[model samples]
Target: MQRTFLQPDDVRDLVTDQFGGGRRPIALDRLTGGSKKGVYRLRLDDHSTAILYVWSAGENYWPPSLTVPDDPFTDASGAELFAVSHAALVAAGVGTPQVLALVRGSRYFDADVALVEDAGVDTLEAVMERDPGAAVGPLSALGDGLRRLHTTVGAEYGKLAAVARGEASQRRRVEDVIVDRALGQLRGAAAHDGRIAEAHDRIAGHVRHLRGAVAERRAYGLIHGELGPDHVLVSPAGEPLIIDIEGLAYFDVEWEHAWLQLRFGDAYPMLRPVDLDPHRLRLYRYAQVLSLIEGPLRIADTDFPERQWMLDLAERNIAKALAAV
Candidate 1:
């Protein structure tokens, strides 16, 4: 069944309250690709625009049973998570949409709503495809921003929100947590795809081998758990502004480079990523591939517009993961 999304009328009062009656909402259209929250482009009568992020039970696709709210690697959604991640990114000098107004327990809807500046509609992926050199400046800026983000670490490794609240972490080492996530993702992928199921044992064995090869580390870097090119917006001024930042965590930077390698592909070199441990990168590559395979397959079950793309991504990563083993 299709659900009704918020319209201009639904948030007309909100726009009036925030931007005043002179800037009432003229149009409200939902943007594609945000599975955890409702991303809508709100246009005002004067033609100015803002992005609305709504966190409600109706918007989120993940079930409550599957979420580990405090875990660094679990379903990291909700208004609190977004606020915390946004604060962390802002403090680290990362580019993001400026927060306009934060409405909690809104009268329009029983949810949290955030009004933010519009960072343009074109993502880094589209900009990169428009021309080979289109993404170079943005990617270089992203490299500099990521350096500041990664170097901004904490005493305990976990979601930035938990760390902010002085929560104690159960995992002793980042490597151990990564290996556990890999094993979990391996099982999830095997259950979803027959080809992955066939080589499950072999892949599991290789994961165990890689686990042992990783050395102990005392520190980890902050990371945007999912940094796909699509998640990055290329502003008109040729800047890379990060979106969907609810997954900021203090973890191994190699986990980040592994994602950059997978998502950025041929364009990875433009970012000029630095100081990644080869051993962590190797293990993280397998873990990242398994995660990529499992994630797309899982999200494909939702009412996402790019359903076929998700399945294709899963298939490609499955091939990559199987070959690596």
Candidate 2:
């Protein structure tokens, strides 16, 4: 197992500092499913539990093709951006863990840590997998939750850091970001295979045309860039709470809807409403697939299991995108 950044002693001390002395954490159970952060369930001396999220230092969670800055602690001073985003979601009446404390670059952990209330809810993915038939309620609740989330908007369409710092002028358009990234990935993949290179040339014009079409009709809102079944937790009573607000951004709502549809369209058809433009959604879907394959394609070899799967997926998505065009 990879060594976790947050230790038990560190959790105990953090809890004690937030709640005062003598309230030490009795247990620290590392939770799974985070890609770039360590999540732990910390049990306090009083038996209450909290969620500790330790941010990884300088890890790029997104594909290398994307232009997101490499800075790990993009959150403002004392993790102000992180705290503000969570607070905004809570204020919007969305179900989220109450942020108890935001530890910015602690010496002990050497990373930013957030202590939040543990909701002790099962993830929507878990519920869906365990009982597919009973997943309708939670899926519907998730749709409604997304509707509420989209209502929270930002001043510009980019990283929260740039927007919060009055640097929105430097922000790029969502359409441009997607198309540029897809082009870069497709070009790189093309270099490895003649078929991929041919497909890249064919898709290049289609991507640009689709980008223009979508840009003319895009609506901006707060989108959970990485929202999926796993990010949604459901209470015993069936209410859904969204976690992993790190990817939150103001962008085309179609991007979020497209991603949700790509992941859960068949399992939960109602997850995607019927009104979204099919062409734009397909464009985003193509962009998403390109993004997924970039990391694995960047590798020099295809012997790894993940690399082979990503290559196969890339082919399928390329065909799908071409057929749509």
RMSD of each: 1.9, 4.4
Instruction: Give per-model TM-scores.
Output: 0.94, 0.80
Which candidate gets the maximum TM-score versus the true structure? Answer: 1
Candidate 2's TM-score reads 0.80
Clashing pairs in 2: none
lDDT of 1 at 109: 82
Candidate 2's clash total is 0
lDDT by residue (1-325, candidate 2, tens digit) is: 2243455786656777788896887778877555456678988878888888777643223233334342211232235556766876777777777788888887656778888878775888888889986788878767766777776665567655556776554345556767876787777667766666767767788778777766454456777776788888887777778888876666767778878877775764656443566767768877777655554555425223245565676667656655755
lDDT of 2 at 31: 77
Error of 2 at 235 (Å): 1.8
Candidate 1 off by > 4 Å: 63-71, 168-170
lDDT per residue (tens digit) for residues 26-127 in model 1: 899999877789999999889999999999877876433333333487867777888888988998999988899888888878889999989888999998
